[model samples]
Target: MECLLGLLKVKVVRGVNLAICDPLTHSSDPYVVLRLGQQKVKSSIKYHTINPEWNEELTLSITNMMHPVKIELFDHDTFTKDDSMGDAEFCILDFVEIAKRDLSDVPDGTVMKTIHPEKANCFATESHITWKDGKISQDIVLKLRNTETGELVLHLHWVNIPGVAR
Candidate 1:
């Protein structure tokens, strides 16, 4: 299946107004962990801050659209263990319809419709689709479950693999 893999590029832009998980210090050393099946990638830790800007990019070979990508926020700690702040999940199927649209066929400033997850612990309110960098890309803003306090921004690009069916 590796030969049929499509590249999914995910850019974890930044987080805003994240929950302060550390009660003692009233701040959190936040970092993001992205998981797609057995593959996992982590961002650099931002010490003692509720808001962290990690403009990190990760590329994953996706063989199945059924597998949802998990995004979890954690507070890095030196002592015991990392604390779970919040989490969100999104599937590549969410963007399948929009991604199938050819970028060259669409006019500039054309905004594709946003997609929402059917069931998710954390999910983006909306995604803005635009033609950028010679391809179609999306900017997604995800909000934490059970509260409107935490927000995480992500940029995603779908790179088509030759001989793979969309």
Candidate 2:
């Protein structure tokens, strides 16, 4: 099953209105970290700003569609421990569904197709899917929780590999 799927590219576009962990001070240096399975990627630290823009892209060799990608925000510290700002997560099941449907045109096997989310739901507002450059991509905006207020914007591209079983 590991060799059946292709790579998934995740682009961490930017963060908006991140919570300031250090309220006593003026501003906090914010940074983002993304985790998927054992793979981890960190964004550059934006110094003394509430709204940090980290236009970074990370790629992951996806084998399982059930795994959810974790996005964690933190305040960088020089001496002491880093403060945890907030976090958000999103799954790639929708992308996998699209990929399977797009690859169904191949000669040999039949792949399953799924419907896109068009109604108001928990995972509907910030998630969207589209086809571009012979690939299926999704853009997601996740609202950070366990803190005051924060949001993370992400763009994911799923490349389809030929001759792979769905």
Which is the leading candidate under lDDT?
1
Q: Tell me the spans in candidate 2 whose CA falls farther than 4 Å from its real position.
A: 103-124, 161-166
Q: Each model's number of backbone clashes? A: 0, 0
How well does candidate 2 score on lDDT at residue 2?
A: 57
Full-model lDDT, candidate 1: 0.77
> Using alpha carbons, what is the TM-score of model 1?
0.82
Model 1 backbone overlap count: 0
lDDT (tens digit, per residue) of candidate 1 on 1-166? 3444577889988888988878888788999888988889888999988888888988877766778888888889899889888888776775655666556767776767656644643555656676665666888888865444788889898888887775
Q: Say which candidate scores most in TM-score.
A: 1
Worst 10 residues of 1 by lDDT: 115-124
Each candidate structure's TM-score, on Cα atoms with residue i matched to residue i, is: 0.82, 0.79
- As for candidate 1, its clashing pairs are none
Ten-residue region with minimum lDDT total, candidate 2: 113-122
